[model samples]
Target: MIYRRFGRTEQRISVFSLGSMRLVNVPPAQAQATVEAAVAAGINHIETAQAYGHAESLLGEILQTLPVPRQQLILTTKLTPQPQDQLRESLQGSLTRLRVDYLDQLAFHGINLPEHLQWVLQEGLPVLRQAQKEGWVGHIGFSTHGSLDLILEAIQTGSFDFVNLHYHFFQQRNRSALEAAAQQDMGVFIISPADKGGMLYHPPQRLQEVCQPFSPLEFAYRFLLADPRIHTLSLGITQPQELQTAWAALRDPEGGWGNVLRQVQQRLQEREQEHLGTTRCAQCYACLPCPEGIHIPEVLRLRNLALAHDMTEFGQYRYNMFGQAGHWFPGVTADCCTECGDCLPRCPEQLQIPDLLRETHQLLHRSPIRRLWE
Candidate 1:
């Protein structure tokens, strides 16, 4: 139950924040138990969003029953970027749904595209700032699933008191963004580390073996928390038992994980090198400007993990998200590669780009799972 100061907001948020998106998908009783379990585990920060399908409503019912007082918990919610005039109503709606008069934090949800950021600065911020002045909201921030450039641009704006974005062991692509947030003194909340972080919740045998002395989930948790830039990791819980299970694995009693983290990292690297050889994707993002708009590094990274560590489940899970996730995961799958040889010259490794793209498609492509919203 380690707590970190969430940057400029100065709120001490727990290392793990309870996320409600998955809760809304489960039965109400389970959801209530899960929220109670999270609070019992000392998770003070609870985040929900307007787009999360009655999650706020359920929390409204559950919060009234919790033993803890309302003022003691740090409650947060988000709404999409709205027009200036509609922003107050949107904020009030979330308040009504949560049965709360004020929020500890309010975020402009899903600023994943450049246009979304533009709208937030031009139309949304004024209303949100007013809300803050009016005491309906405390701190202002945003959540993003956009490119590195877009994230960097948003951080440079210096308007946010915190940020909720993706950064984990498997996806260190956003490492620079994490550093930038630290520079701005902004709160850094990591979203979906166990699930989107290579589906470590049900990790492959190779990953399990490589992360010796710690489960994949445990290693992922430790690895992120080791970095002081990260303030909290969002845990999506649908049931009470899920929270218990995860926290049980994450608790380190002896407290000598630094040495273990180093050892396991070496093993993971060696495993990648053993199977991937020299053609392994460096993840440099140098092989960009693919005329076909394929996200080359991500595709090949997934391919490397699947081929090297038997992480086919994780690979397929993300590969299938190609077009369905919209701006959240914006890029076509490698099956759309046109063999133009455009990215080849840009790649420092000079690996067989088109051939690898075809291989990625063959190895990981599958029927798209229904989108989370669906």
Candidate 2:
């Protein structure tokens, strides 16, 4: 496994981290085998959270049977911000489930809003500080799916030792946040690079063709690994086969991957140019600050992806997520566009903003799926 310096934490973390969310519902025996395979493959970091159902408990059972010493493992778990009085009890429950006395890292999980950040500062920080003093917590950090502005706000507070957020090839929205975290010398862990990163696990035929020798999933992994700012990428695994795939991807050297990446990227651009012509949204954010609180740019990007790359399913899934995502994604969908023409003068591409919004609404809106968890 490839290792990188985890910024301020100063630990050599495996570029691939074992994410425990998917293990929550798996049979115990299978979960144990998956964990063993990951550890044997040299994955030193394991990340879980209270929100991931029974993941911590299953991991606790596996930890006891592992051949390696406990000190060699870097364990991280997170808690949502709550009243100060309840913080310790909640953390204790996680500790009990994990069968660990102390956590290498504890994060304020899902700090996706300015209000969430305020709650963490007002009620959660003091409790986490106390835990750090008591040796129950080694470091304090946060994980977010918030807007880039909110994420940068949290990073600028200088209160966190590390950050876990979304940053990948399909979604470069958080690129600036990653740079800001690196400047603070904070460890940057990407949340989900496979499932949420364009669902590369089941790639479309065109994407597979363009990516060439590399599988779509491996291309996504290598794309993120090419950037040094990212410390680790989460491999949310349920089966041992998934772990093996990730291990193989990480073990593949970076020598020729760069050239391959450039070729694939060039091919993607050429495809987009051919299909989308000159009227596609540049995603420059100038058409933002919509009067009706519509996420105009995001909606347009989804539309462009669908039109440019025939990624209709992927686009539809994300477009449907807008209203349901609440503060995490924020803003209504293109249906909220009122055609006031306010965004027209601001758009450098001069594409019909309101018209595009209407087109997006038509192409991407569909019956929403109930999220399994928040």
Top lDDT model: 1
Candidate 1 per-residue lDDT, tens place, 1-374, comes to 88999999999999889999988888899899899999998999999999988889999999999999998899999899766888899899999989999999999898999999999999999888988899999999999988899999999999999999898888899999998999999999999888888888798888898987888888888888878899899998787777754575456734634777888989999999999998799899999978788999999989988988889998998998887877778789898988888898889888898999899999998998645755
lDDT for 371 in candidate 2 is: 42
Quote the positional error of residue 332 for candidate 1 in Å.
0.8
Q: How many clashes (backbone atoms < 3 Å, residues ≥3 apart in a chain or on different chains) does model 2 have?
A: 0
TM-score, each model?
A: 0.97, 0.95
Q: For residue 323, give model 1's deviation from the true position in Å.
A: 1.5
Clashing pairs in 2: none
lDDT by residue (12-62, candidate 2, tens digit) is 899999999988777888888889988998899999999888888888888
Which regions of candidate 1 are displaced past 4 Å?
245-250, 253-256
Model 2 TM-score?
A: 0.95
